[model samples]
Target: MSRILAFIFRRRGHGRGWHWTDIATWIWLIGGTILMFGPALWLVASSFKGPAQLAEFPPTLLPYVQQTAMVEGYDAPLPLYTTTQEDGSTKVLAEIRRIGVNSQMVDPGNPGERINVNIADRSPVREIGLATGNYVEPLVKNNFLRFLWNSVFVTVMATLITLFTNSMAAFALSKYRFRGRDGVMLLIVATLMVPLSVILVPLYSVVNAMGLLNSLWGVILPTVATPTGVFLLRQYMLTIPDELLEAARMDHASEWQIYWRIVLPLAAPALAVLAIFSVVWRWNDFLWPLIVLSQREHYTLQVGLNTYAGELNVQWHYILAMTVVTMIPVILVFLFLQRFITTGIAGAGIK
Candidate 1:
């Protein structure tokens, strides 16, 4: 590990000694990494903490749980503490009960007699422990599997549909010359400025008219035709040479053949970028799913996780665990297709 670290930080391009700019660059990179990943690390740590540890005044990054010892006569385990005596000696004692400022403690070895110690003199014996129950209980009790299935279905189906529809729109706008072609592209781009909140009511009404409310398709259909996807694909498709389509036409190729065989394959990088965007959008979508799906069994993961929150109390542990789980798919998708992002975006605006 030391060798690997040394090699990674070795001065290859710089002179014999490290420069001030190199130091500043390393600092900036390290700071940016921590800044971006700090909250995610905190969430992972907090997900493993028990309720009592979570409620600590000065919260700890590591999950520390109070230790307990089973006394001889006691049916249940008692909390253990290290108490400081007047003689400046510390002894491990099991706390039986506490009354105001003083606690009744017994030596676990000899539990016959009780000793009174001031609460201030005793500190809890705690060790780093993970609360695995936070992750387990929700999966077992709640319909987590159903929610996962619904979310997966929505994300996959929505991404497929988004790619197909947006690519068709982009192909037409970029390749074909018609009287209202620019007008149509301008109209689609204009919709990007309209916030989702403005169309929710009418969109809801339209879905209801189609009898799609309370179904996964209702959530999937409304968001599949995104203006950003159309614009991105159209820009990328513009960079494709027109001579390719003309060559296909000269070879007795149909419009569908030109689109499927010639155009779609060439636009793969842009499609990958759109796929990533669609998956993330559909996976994390909450409002549309919440408004459409009324049944618990039909709920997506985002809406299902909301059920953990109540009017009075919120189940942070389960919520945090499930939230981490929800992020896994999106993370995997981004990591898989991330290589294409720069290529796609850079090519999209060219020509």
Candidate 2:
């Protein structure tokens, strides 16, 4: 009886006893994953799609491979159909559009022997040529590789600056007690409520005053003093016990040494989390970069990608292809630092 009962409840300890709520949780997770990843998958797929395949009747997920579908008529694009020629011999005729929905066969080399084929009795064989020019053409024509390099430079520099400044500020705020420190902290947190748009004009004026206009330095400098980053680092740093710092101090470690050696090493997890956020923020940054830099050579990947658009038509294939390329760094950074984010957030938030 015990064996029988055990066999019946074999999964009891495996997944918290497998309630209906577990099924609901799984449904929600699968649904959320699809929702988040579907559009990104579509964008990558669309990058490889040909122009005709973009509007194909039955939507295709994979890129349409260039294949020759038979062309029915003449070299000049005509529909093919079976028609009886002069000797009652059947010849295939390629059709040309006529008035209304009607179509007619082009006159053969001899205009006098016009093939007036029936509207319903033609079996047209195919001859459609396929082209896959989008992916390679844009990169070659638009100097996209240079833009990619510029984007990489900007993202790396901005993330490094933000990490250094934010972490230093966080260490001071979290580890030290000073007169008016609470007020300074309050002021920094208060900046979070103010949107960047509200101060754009002033910020630009400041950048211009420093003679950083139309430079990468202009774009990188303004973003370094992020209030949110300071707050996040402070929260994470607060979780590090003071006893560790005191021991270092007893060894005659200077304030800067204590911060550089002791605090930073212990705060690696939080720094990793911050680095991920900083990379994503700087990588996707477009507006400021656009406003600061005007020269084509200096343009980041996002701004340079705008050159593909025109008043007449937008080249979606180029846009999609470049967008996928631009996203690679952010995805890689997240993957590298993802393990630290959850743990750091929990430690910082709870402490």
Candidate 3:
């Protein structure tokens, strides 16, 4: 009976241990979710607040308070008369002051009338109401739409060019065996070690000579050939079964046909992954675009966002609003494409 009791006690302890492990995993998941999403939640909440509520001490997260002040009636500047006191001192005053709903005139019989005044409803101060205009103003004032268009243009064109060139080079390195093929691959890979800054001056000179400075092409042309993209795609392509290519060749498929039909579709997942990276990189790119394009019209979203940071004073609220706006596109792209990345990596590995 003592032995039986001891075994039962041990089994109970093992059950508790498993229960604790399950609880730990749940806690970890909850904590990670909060850490990842807390700032974004705060930003979205803050975007709805009015300026005063946002600055309130002991800071209120919700915009529930509404305060209003009365000014002298609506004649331009609302006339305030000066009264000469007995000793030649003069006083100026607004006609009305309020405590609760009741309001009293400063001087019972002032000539000017009082009007209920409403301050322009500025952007949401606290985390309560939506201030649509705060988000809207930056887009209109800064030519954000044009900047967006330029960013899209550059990203798409550059990504397409990068994909085409890199894939072609990668296909050559992967499929063809010739004298010095391995040496050529090594040399191409070696270029990846060179820092982009080292070539900026020479690249700038080439763009300037071509008269492409300040042009979208200048931003697109230099990055059309990325060694990283080539290297990554080549590794992926090597995993493709040679038997498939040989079968296509037996059917009298040309090299281009084999690449177009057989290789490209099988390589879709890897290409999608590359495309997402290319788009995000080009979209967020600032320094290169700043160096290449001097014109404001050609500025990308990243460059345009910098205008909010002035030499003398930074408009923190406006800058924050614009920043929130700018992140939307990147977030959307990532959300849409993130599903492909893991699958692409797995597919590439299988090949």
The whole-model lDDT of each prediction reads 0.88, 0.75, 0.71
Candidate 1 — which residues are off by over 4 angstroms? 1-31, 66-124, 306-310, 333-339, 342-351
lDDT of 3 by residue, 137-161 (tens): 7678767778879988999999999
lDDT of 1 by residue, 18-44 (tens): 788878989999999999889988998
Mark the regions of model 3 whose C-alpha exceeds 4 Å error after superposition. Answer: 1-32, 50-59, 62-127, 342-351
Which one wins on TM-score?
Answer: 1
Find the candidate with the highest lDDT and give its number. Answer: 1
Estimated TM-score for each candidate: 0.77, 0.72, 0.72
The TM-score obtained by model 3 is 0.72
In TM-score terms, candidate 1 sits at: 0.77
Candidate 2 — which pairs collide? 70-126, 70-127, 71-126, 71-127, 80-124, 81-122, 82-122, 82-123
**Residue 212, candidate 1: C-alpha displacement in angstroms:** 1.9
- Stretches of candidate 2 off by over 4 Å are 1-28, 68-133, 306-311, 334-336, 342-351
Worst 10 residues of 3 by lDDT: 118-127
Answer with 1 or 3, whichever has the higher TM-score: 1
Could you tell me how far off, in angstroms, the CA of residue 233 lies in candidate 3 after the best superposition? 1.6
